[model samples]
Target: MNTILVTGGTGYVGSWIVKGLLDKAYTVRLTVRDKDNTAKFENLRQIALTTKGKLEIWEADLLEEGSFDDAALGCDAILHVASPFTLRFKDAQRDLLDPAIKGTRNVLYAASKSGTVKKVILTSSVAAIHGDTKDMTEQGLTEFNEEQFNQSSSLTHQPYSFSKVEAEKEAWRIAQAQDEWKLVVINPSFVMGPSLSSLSNSESLNFMKDILSGKYAMGAPAIMFGFVDVRDVAKAHILALENENSQGRHLLAERTIDVLEYAQLIEKAFPQKFKLPKKHAAKFLLLMVGWMFKLSSQFIKRNVGYPLRLNASKSREALGLDYIPLEQTVKDMVTQMLDDKLI
Candidate 1:
């Protein structure tokens, strides 16, 4: 069986990827920032106990150079899924950029040192595809696909997206410089589904809680997202590693819809349990009260009423995936959050 290393194995999206790998009977070496924080991985350990796969947790910090060498040694493949993702940050460079760019460099450099690694699968985001939703029309594209790289995001604004683009570009540069290990990138849209742990730091969980907790009681902006399930993202990563032909980048969005549509799906499933947004707030209204939700005025003007689309033929044909429906994804997400008392 292949022994693989999964960075950020305790994260919302990362945990699902770990579970997928274990289901296939692969020996997984997982990295966590704090080995002392065993509470975060209790659910995962429980799953491993019931499965044929073995689990090993190692400590690795993203900022410290060479911190991942111990975990990267002797793995057949490395799934780089650890990156800071947050809109709530005072220092962009401290919180996002340094960790993303420097961390990618450190991890791959460690892989280069590790004599046995054959492939590296990076978990990038559609954020690397474009910064704002309005960029589709501005960039003269009918759909944002693998060919597009976000050029509009900056440190002061859309910093998370900027970090992803820089990290992905750095991965490509590193991969080209070496013939020993190849790189493949999975650029997923908004990933939503059940997380293994309830106390996750994922912005996705926060977004869902805000929706169900009436933060958008009046309404929400008309921004659209190309949505995909968390499990599918993991599946795509494994497929990329297994398929020698799976080179370059693959966009992993199953469908596209606005926040209002997502709200409707949750409402349809959990009818009377929580507050759900019923209408789209006007752009002017969003811009006026943007600070309340941490979204800037420029973001509102550019993306509040724009459309988003992603070409999925590459993922469909190359990964051979049957994606989970957006509606079902939302429903399952809400149910799990409720059961976990996360929302």
Candidate 2:
């Protein structure tokens, strides 16, 4: 597509997609919550100046209906990448679910009404596939694939995952009712890499900061999860848009590793003394004290000490994505955080 509408274009994963689209000379209409906040999108604007692509900033709110109508109109394609990833929330429905489900509805509605948008790529998450690590064995599957939908997440447990699942479902419901626009879902695991905007406050970056800042030095919960590079995730979105044959959901994950193994990767990349967790915290210990870390007992019981695995063959074969190694991903992210004084 020559002209595209990208929601959350200034976000962590969305920024990378915007960069790739600009590099390919596509006119990108970026929708933000506030177009007046130039600093939030200055990095993207600077990149736009050097590329052949045109960048247009528009103000829109995810919670408001029809907010994306003006920005999405006349766009050849739409990349719905804006969604909250925070785990901390006072109200699950208001903080996470509303923005996610409503945002998906609004974006897809805009695309459907635009009459020009033929392709829509929704940025879902692996959290939508399986709620917790234990779901793998419980479901009698070796690894999670495109066919699965998370069944364990609820309003009180892993609310973030619940929001993603509901949002993705809403996208599918909207996409099915109409044939004018085809929907492609990109379900990426924990996205990690250097962000284009240093001021970006993503949960992925916060997870890294927690590790390097000694919050988990004593011991990290033995939580295993999938990891993927932000760049790779962005590439998947573009590939989905470019390849007409691409259909259904594409799971984008490089590999699976536990908290302790992640620390080891960091140590291997840095080789410098940082308060990296040397070992996994005992499950019982975590169960007793998990509340101190804002971890629900149900979350700790279901996720801790369980291995998370996924089958990303579709992303590789269909999207032709060669995933980045976790070591390099960790190195680049740590280096950027250091430069930004975030860690």
Candidate 3:
């Protein structure tokens, strides 16, 4: 029950999960697309060098079926955290849906075949709970929770969110078909904070860079969203693994804030370095300039200025999360990006 395999071990969320497991002295096997890509996982290797936990890397591909069999062998559990989270894609179905759904099937099938896996912790998202911030009111709910499922997003809009919800559905379908392993899901909001690895694949880190580098200096669109620290997301996974009583899905978010507030936090943290936006741009202006930011008027009207609410009571009571302050999260992320010369 001590051996655990983590998919996308080099990713932002997965890397932190690996670090937490290592800190707890658990044997962690990481599956990557390529074992020779040392640059992506060098931080993990250094962690193994300093910790008592044993770390191993194996090759696996999300799109390739049966790719995770070698890594899943002899493992007690799995953390499936690998999935694309990009806005720039030629085809949403090809780039997001196929991999997310097919990838979940691949990993879960691998675990089912392993016959040793006791639990499968799926890294789902708050996106799966609610696609748009303004969705709560229409559904007669004040805040989002584990019971909700995203129904607004599709291939044409918020494709990433659609992928997450669909993937979770597919995982649940696979889990219900067998009794060999139990499934638990961790639905984290927009994850931010320092990365365990110095890799540039994370969209969160990239968003911070854009914020500081004046990408939104001309007044950002007021797209309200929920956010959580990356470390907290990792900790939630650890709690789920240790607490055998824990089951089903849990929502993880420190708080809800808007794009303007986020920029202000960054501005306060780094006084003269970043030219953070002074105000949220007018919705009409955003609509006119939507193409520049790859947004549409409909999206701007739906999300801009709308607040998002998340009820993380389940995670608080079940996973014992005290949560991290957004200010500290912003500061830590900025400092890390500076130290790594990423900005």
Range of the 10 consecutive residues with the lowest summed lDDT in candidate 1: 193-202
For 1-343, candidate 3 gives per-residue lDDT tens digits of: 6999999778888889999999889999998887898888888989988898989988999999999987898999998988888777899999999999999999999999998999999999999999977788678887889999998899887899999999999999999999999999999999999987676668898788778889888898888878999999999999998889989999998888888898988878778778889988998888899888888677777788776789999999988888999999999988888888898
Instruction: List, residue by residue over 1-343, the lDDT tens digit for candidate 1.
Output: 2999999888888898889888889999999888898998888999998889999999999999999998888888899999998888889999999999998998898889998898999999999989999899898889988999998899987999999999999999998999889899999999888778878878888889899998887997799998899989988998898898888899998899999988888888889778878899988888889998888988888898877888988999988978999888888888898898786
User: After superposition, which runs of candidate 1 have C-alpha atoms over 4 Å from their true positions?
Assistant: none
Clash count for each candidate, listed in order shown: 0, 0, 0
TM-score to true structure, per model: 0.98, 0.98, 0.97
RMSD of 2: 0.9
Q: Which stretches of candidate 2 lie over 4 Å from their true place?
A: none
TM-score of 1: 0.98
Name the top TM-score candidate: 2
Worst 10 residues of 2 by lDDT: 270-279
Model 1 Cα displacement at 146 (Å)? 0.3
Per-residue lDDT of model 2, residues 34-68, tens digit only: 77889999999999999999999989999999999
Error of 2 at 316 (Å): 0.3
Which residue pairs come into collision in candidate 3? none
